[model samples]
Each structure stands twice: as C-alpha cells, then as structure tokens.
Target: MSIVDGNPNVDTTVFYNASNENNLLYPDKFHQWQTRNNFKSYRQIGRFSDNEIAEHLPVDKDKTVVLIGGPDKMGSHWIKALKQMGIERSQIYYEKFSW
Candidate 1:
C-alpha cells in the first residue's frame, strides 16, 4: 500500500496551521507500516503539483484509490487523470473538503 500525503507543511493538524501534520502523524508511523506490503508514504510539502500526482500514482488494475482532503476542483482533476490512466470509476473514491 502507498500513501500520498500533501500538507502546507510537515505538521498534521485538524485545524489549519503551519505544522498541523505533526498532530496526526506519530513518530515512525510510516516506517512501522512499511513492514507489510511495502507500505510507503509520499509527503508533498507545500504545493502539490500535477507532476507530483502523475509521478506518485501509477496505473494498476487491482488498485483501490481513495482521493480525500483537497479542493473540490483539484479532486475532479485528479479523477480525470486517474481515468486517463485506465483506472475505473468504480475503483476510485473521493472525499472532498466541504469548505
């Protein structure tokens, strides 16, 4: 399993903050998870470019992808990209930020 995490900074927070990610991620969480199925986490500090999205996400028929916590428009763009990669719509899930 692979995770692509994007935040304004290194911290994880429920609320908006410079270092919010620290609030959500425990120390060595990524490393610990990597023991099974080669769990990997890709952290995108600051802006998440389309290039990064294209790079991290690979085309896989058996992949289950969930797109969460981003702008609604960006989510749509991501869905489109996934479609172009031959990812089926039923295999994609998205939870867009309400705000």
Candidate 2:
C-alpha cells in the first residue's frame, strides 16, 4: 500500500477513502493522477499530527509511502510518523510542491 498527501494545507486530518469522492479535497486531480498512473488502488491522507497520520498507514512490512507536501510541519510530521511505524527511509519519497 502507498499513501500520498491529498491536501497539505488542510487544518485537520482528513482521510480520503475514495469510496466517498465528495469527501476528498482534490478529487479531480487525485483521480487524474491515479488513472494516468494506472494504479489499481490508492490511498490519500491529510494530517498535521504524526500519531494521527501513523494510525492510518498500512501495517504491511513492505508498504511504500509517498509524501507530496511542503518541507515544513505538515510534511515533516508525516515523515516522522512513517519512521515511527518502522518504514525504512528508502521506502519513503518526498515531493515538495509550491501552491
């Protein structure tokens, strides 16, 4: 399983289940990327808290996590959470984007 950031600016942690498209902050963009990449499934999670973010991650030992956010608090917290969950540094990828 792979986790990506849906919207880093969101003040609260929001899980994008995809089952409920209306709850996703960037449904169109996320859908486009997912389709273009030809991924069978994807999971998006937006959060500012490390513990909260960690709770939503997959427990698999080999899960890959991709983070798309700034290099600030939001991104750092996610990285921290992933680390706490025992995901190796090599399994993580960070992409910073300017609004």
Candidate 3:
C-alpha cells in the first residue's frame, strides 16, 4: 500500500497504490482523470491546525471544504472547530474510512 500525496504540503489522498497492490481503485474504474488522475496545483494543508485551516480557507462562501480521514476522533474535532470558525455544515463534507 502507498499513499499518493496529492500535494507535498498536505498529506491528503491517502489512497492505496492499486498498481503496487495489483488491485483496482473502485472510483478509478468508473471515473478516471484525463491527465494525472489527481489534483494539481493546490496548496497542501499538511495537517495544519483547525485555526490555520480556517485562516487559509477561501473567502468565497460557496467554496466547499472536504475533510477525509480514517474513523478517528480528530475528524470530529476538526468539524467542531471549523463550525466555530463560522464554516457552515452545508459547506463541509466529511468522509471517514472504516479500514
């Protein structure tokens, strides 16, 4: 297994390396990127604090914030902190992995 760091700054996209594991990623089977199959040119959060995340969040209220991680308590804390920073529930998406 390998974690494909989408951005050097943030350790997001903790996906398994299908090629290395000889298995196919479920989403990639149906929807595939035309180019790099990953995001490009976005700054990394690098596991920054909730305050830092709030500070760096774009001013555009329409922007969506996605927080993904394993089923950990830290994710809940992050949500709470973001809410305290005035981030709306509609603007945040939290995805937790069981495995």
Predictions: Cα RMSD each: 8.5, 9.1, 9.3
**Tens-digit lDDT track for model 2 on 40-71?**
33354443345655665666747554544554
TM-score versus the correct structure, for each prediction: 0.53, 0.46, 0.45
| TM-score-better candidate, 1 vs 3 | 1
TM-score of candidate 2 on Cα atoms, chains taken together: 0.46
Best by TM-score: 1
Each candidate: what lDDT? 0.52, 0.51, 0.49
Ranking by TM-score: 1, 2, 3
Candidate 1, residues 1-99, lDDT tens digits: the string is 133244222222121112255543444655554444534455533545557655655545565454455679867977787677667788777778753
Overall local distance difference test of candidate 1? 0.52
- Candidate 3 residues lying further than 4 Å off, grouped into runs, are 1-47
As for TM-score, the candidate ahead, 1 or 2, is 1
The per-candidate count of clashes, in order, stands at 8, 0, 1
